[model samples]
Target: MNKIHYLMNREVNYTLSKCFLTRLTGWEEVPLVKTDACGLVLFRFNNDFTGLRFKLVLNDIEILTAAHIHLGMRGENGQVVAFLFGPVTRGISVNRGVVTGIIVESDLTGPLQGMSLLELARKMEIGNSYVNAHTENHPNGEIRGQIKRF
Candidate 1:
């Protein structure tokens, strides 16, 4: 292929491979909490899929403590594979806000320990992963949503 054609194809592939989105709700949490708390998370994978940039926005949540990407199917609680917000020393009061971060191989834990970020991406692509947010009132998890391609 010509240089221009190759570059065009590369750009298209990069955009197509990059995004995943999820909508979090208290109802999705295991044991189902009764709260209006909800949120959305967006994951943008790098071109090589070796890492990702994530943005999480929460609404009506209180005393937010932590957020993470867990490895599991919907309606199941799973081990944390990556942290998006603090497993903070203390909960931070929040009504609505955003958390942003980048995750790479080194940031992985639990079942993903020592694995490449691509492994995580593969699991997420298959709907075997989720994003969960925790609060002081629900330390186990206040809200959650399964990750899926955008």
Candidate 2:
């Protein structure tokens, strides 16, 4: 069965290490990093699900910032897929057909709207790649995710 695993501290580190320049500046925040960057947090997902973005509603098409899902480790192929959920247009199907949901950091109030783990590839799912600034730049900075066990 497909597993939709949310982003975790461990997974965030995995993506940062790949960036040749991330180590020096640290994996903190690279101001200029948009949801469009190669990594998960770099840029927003196609509809939002591809990155660590959050989902606002289940039945309707809505998304929020702050994706909880973490980018996974790269496999033999760095496969990435963007599953975005924008406002539905006229002549479009709703409440039924597959309407890709954008990932976001909303609370339990919001849930994913599109492809499940079984439907998508391992590397294409949403992962942690959210940043605060828009134009700021990182010369070796990074955004770290800390984890504590109970």
Candidate 3:
């Protein structure tokens, strides 16, 4: 019983230590546009590696439309794997706020369809993923950042 408890505690600590962070800015976007918008994303994997909890904070953004995690390298575009924010009405905007959610296997789509959360976490570990924030002014992506483990 003591051995089992120790193993469980170790797993919990390991999960808590698996964190990724990214800073979003327009300059990171392809065909970069000038904008005052910026944001940050934090991703943490669950104990069982079956879910990803994320928090995205945006500032000075306008007419916000959506945010997503994409499977791609820096300076490249990729298909969306998970939606972080609204595909809401185009007129909606945010000056400053936070959007938090958990992404599971079912949330995986596009090229990530049927993939496990562990697969996505592995992608992030290797710098093959990015977070993109979309706005009315830049539907493609107003701000972008490469996800990195930290």
> Measured by TM-score, how close is model 3 to the native structure?
0.87
TM-score of each: 0.87, 0.18, 0.87
Worst 10 residues of 1 by lDDT: 9-18
**Candidate 3 per-residue C-alpha lDDT over 28-127 given as tens digits, one digit per residue, 9 for 90 to 100:** 9987979998999999887777888999999999888999999999999999999999788864667899999999999899998998787787788889
* Model 1 Cα lDDT, one tens digit per residue, 71-144: 99998989999999988868887678988889999999999999988778878878999999998989999999
State model 1's lDDT: 0.89
Clashing pairs in 3: none
| Candidate 2 lDDT by residue in tens digits, 1-150 | 123244453354344322111111123332322232222222222332333322222121112222132232311111123333321232222232232243333311222234442222222333322212111232221222211111
Model 3: number of clashes?
0
Error of 1 at 61 (Å): 0.9
How many residue pairs clash in model 1? 0
Q: Candidate 3 regions off by >4 Å? A: 1-17
The reply for model 1, stretches above 4 Å from the true place, is 1-16
Give RMSD (Å) of candidate 1 vs. truth.
Answer: 4.6
Cα error, candidate 2, residue 119 (Å): 8.0
Error of 2 at 104 (Å): 7.7
Model 1, 12: alpha-carbon shift in Å? 16
Please report the TM-score between candidate 2 and the true structure. 0.18
- Weakest 10 consecutive residues of candidate 2 by summed lDDT: 17-26
